[model samples]
Target: MSNESGHTEKLGIDDCTVPETSVSVYEALYRRRMAWDFRNQPVPRDALDRMLATAVWAPNHRLTEPWRFFIIEKGSAASEKVAGLAYDFALQRSGGEQRAAATRDSLLKTPVLIYAYSTPGRDEEGTKENYASVCCAAHNMALAGVAEGLAVTWETGGPTRHPDLAEALGAEADWTLTTMLSVGYPAENPRSERTPVANFVRWLD
Candidate 1:
């Protein structure tokens, strides 16, 4: 009936519009891309605070609110461990040291690593829905990061599944990392490209 004091809203990810004059919702989504290149500059603590403020607005089913965050600050000891794990994950997945080095550097280049976790304890359908919600929450965080003058990516195949790594990030036994965000300033502007929206949409009316 009511909202979380100040967080409740009807705006959903599917309800954004292009920013022709201002940074419209559609424009933000359209402009959003997985940032692979991040500048060495540090993200301000206040700015990250704002990003987290916006991230919790994402929609969830039953308000289970299974979302929890693990912030790996760039210079922190925990952040260094994840960086090493990322390098190992890259080597194992890509089968080479070049890629592993790149992954290690990529994780270390950014100033913040916001690990997104989901608490799972239900059937397949519930698990699927909760993940969907988690992803939506991450998207909001990414866009919020951009809007706050930063770049972010939802990394799904990094070192999240490593039980030891997750424990290092202070996750519970049941909470799994669905995504990790390496966020910072743009080292270089990304090339613009995307699949046409019409290819993925249809008018039913």
Candidate 2:
């Protein structure tokens, strides 16, 4: 199949088989939620890899796939080191030992932490495109995780803004920290509210 962009692709007949489920794409869209409370159970490595594989397929202008992910496995030395840095960063930012400790504990308990970074393009417009593409990739990962029966949340707060954290993640000078995704099994289903599309969308006929 080919679209207006003239990109041709072929799919195997076997690949067209859909799983027997009532969940449609729209259902998946509505069902996916940001999860806060997570279980200590680990997400399988193959499942995580599947999520990432789906993530990289997100549309990008000029095929500039600038997204890069750093996976910090739970209970690993790298995870501990990253958690320590995060704790220090949180303490410095909030000036609360208790809060920092809580944050550290959460990081330690989470099964996977995927740090996303984007390498800037040649010009300002190109850089913006790269950033947007990275956001789409993150969204892809989140939705894919949801489909795999995992809880997922994207965080772009302290770590994304911290220079030390970026350095620790080995991001280059031109690369920008985009997001950090926490993926694991849910401890509980947290309800979320979203404003209707009518509130933000405008129809032009």
Candidate 3:
């Protein structure tokens, strides 16, 4: 049976000798959520690799393959540097030292932060295609994370688009910051409801 998160309950070897392939894809799709709270445990390299691999498979017109991913693991020097950037960015805003410190601490506690960007295309149409392709790639990665039993959130806000963050990521001035994914084990199970298919879909024959 499935749980609230739509994940199948684990089975012993006697219960199932092989991986459950029949419903895995749909299960991942249903299980995916925008996770805000997360454990500080680092995601395994193999799992991360699988997520990226799926991302590359997303269709791109002209096969520009403009997506770029930058992974920052917890407790690493790079993580600290990024956290510092968050702190500085927050401090420069209306919030003072306290809020800045909290922002820094929150980022420090995240297990992994993956920043996604799209390289500038040659023309306006190409740029639009690249943007759409990168968005698809990010969604692909998010679904893969669900399959890995990891919590993931895609965020795009002032903090994500901050010039300081762009500089920290070594992003080119023209490159577009797509979104940032915060990934880790779930500290809490969060449930979300979606609009019924009938509510959003229209059929014409």
Candidate 4:
């Protein structure tokens, strides 16, 4: 029997799925949401790899595929020591309390810590276009995570924008860390309510 706490089941095949052929574009647009409150249980690496692989398939203006993804596995981190030390340094400089430090540790050491960066001015129109492209990539990644049964949260925080942190990761000088993607199983499932699309769309000639 499954647990009744809205947090049972693993995030691999134990998750749910929708038919690729059955869903329409509008339906997909309506389906996406930002999932937070991830479970303590880690998402499997193989599943994450598959979802990220699918995320890069979004359309790009130059076919540049300008985005770069950084993933850190929970309970098996590659940069935990560095990230922890960085958190301490940041707290000292910003005069932030322990709660902020705790949040930083949780985010930086989550099951998947994805940094999506893109070179500035690569998209021609302006920084906005470059950012838009990266945003599209992020949305693709989030949707793919959802399809894989992972709960994800996209966080834009001070660390993501820090020049020193970017340098430590060896991110390119022109690359902006637009957002950090966290992936894991849902800690709790809460139904979402959204404004009707009719409020936003228009058919003008």
Candidate 5:
């Protein structure tokens, strides 16, 4: 199926293709949270693919589609290397051997580590837009993960900005690391409180 713009529509188990259910989108949005504790079970590949598929559909200025994702699946060689890198980074940041060991264990145990990035654009403004676009994409993935019964934690820390880690990932010098998402089944139910919208929202009119 083609839209008015002549782009062929793709079908999947995402929000658009699936039949409407009793679950509302708002519920998914609210259910999405930063999960710190996760089960050791790996997320299904098809579920991860669906989350990424929904992510790419996020709105971007001029349709630049600047987002890129690097997934480190559990038990892969790359995953081991990245986990070591994460351990070293944590050691540097924490300066504690025990903490670093725990950090490394967590990194190794997580079922999936997704490194989201945005390629630099022509100029500063374009680059900024690219970052914004990828951020939206990450949010889309987070929401989709929640819908798929997965826990997702979006993290941007020293490891994500470490030069050695970037080199290990073979990232280009111009590519900006936006965030890293750790996804798996939740081991603990974390509750969060948010301020009322009226506290932050203002009427323009």
Candidate 6:
């Protein structure tokens, strides 16, 4: 395949050593976390652009690049409308004014919101693969955020997947809404644990 410099390079197995860089890929993978608390400051546009650039590199079967991204900035009319929709959805689900208010407040606090989605494919299997590719693309953006010293979280629920919000964001009705990324500067550090790989792995001879 042709590389960035317009040189054709054959793809083949190479050494296992990490590439030389200020931040290693493994470090980014390890440091990536779902950030809930944010500093309420706007993230740099360049940082977000970097994240989107990496997102397009996600692998997809048959190379059906189907991922799409939408950004919502804080304090904008769009943001206010989104929060209002979330409030309405929450009120319907919980039937509590306090809970609905809390949901609106939480969304308003977010500095930036990124919605990732996938375009439908030709058939059922193709559509499923496209959805998976979009998911990978979203994770790529999250990892890129970590490397850029930004916080990111993938959020999805009734409020986020609401059709009204999707229409407001100009997403097509037929496309799938994968997840929304809440991006900002970190206000807190959170830690989590994962089950051992051996617990879920199987060896086949």
The candidate that wins on lDDT is: 6
What are the per-residue Cα lDDT tens digits for candidate 1 across 59-152?
8887777788888778788877888887877777779999889777777767888998888847777777777788888888787766766778
- What's model 1's TM-score? 0.80
Q: In candidate 5, which residue pairs get closer than 3 Å at backbone N, Cα or C atoms, i.e. clash?
A: none
| Backbone clash count for every predicted candidate, in the order shown | 3, 0, 0, 0, 0, 0
Writing each residue's lDDT as its tens digit, candidate 4 over 1-205 gives: 2578875434333343533545455654556555556667767777777667655566667655667876666654445643665576567677777755875677655666777887677345756666777888888767766666766677786546544666666677778787887777777664688798899999999
Off by over 4 Å in 3: 1-23
Lowest lDDT 10-mer window, candidate 2? 12-21
Error of 1 at 176 (Å): 2.4
RMSD of every candidate to native, in Å, equals 5.6, 5.2, 10.1, 10.7, 4.0, 5.3
Which model, 2 or 6, shows the larger lDDT? Answer: 6
Q: 118, model 5: CA deviation in Å?
A: 0.4
Which lDDT value does model 6 have at 145? 83
Q: Estimate, for each residue in 1-205, the C-alpha lDDT of model 3 and write its tens digit.
A: 7999998665444663333334377888998887777876779987888788778668899888899889999998988988898788888885699988987887788898999999878999999999899999989888888878888888785457457787887888788989888889889999988788998888989
- Pull out the clashing pairs in model 3: none
Q: Which pairs clash in the backbone of model 4?
A: none
Worst 10 residues of 4 by lDDT: 10-19
The TM-score measured for candidate 4 stands at 0.74
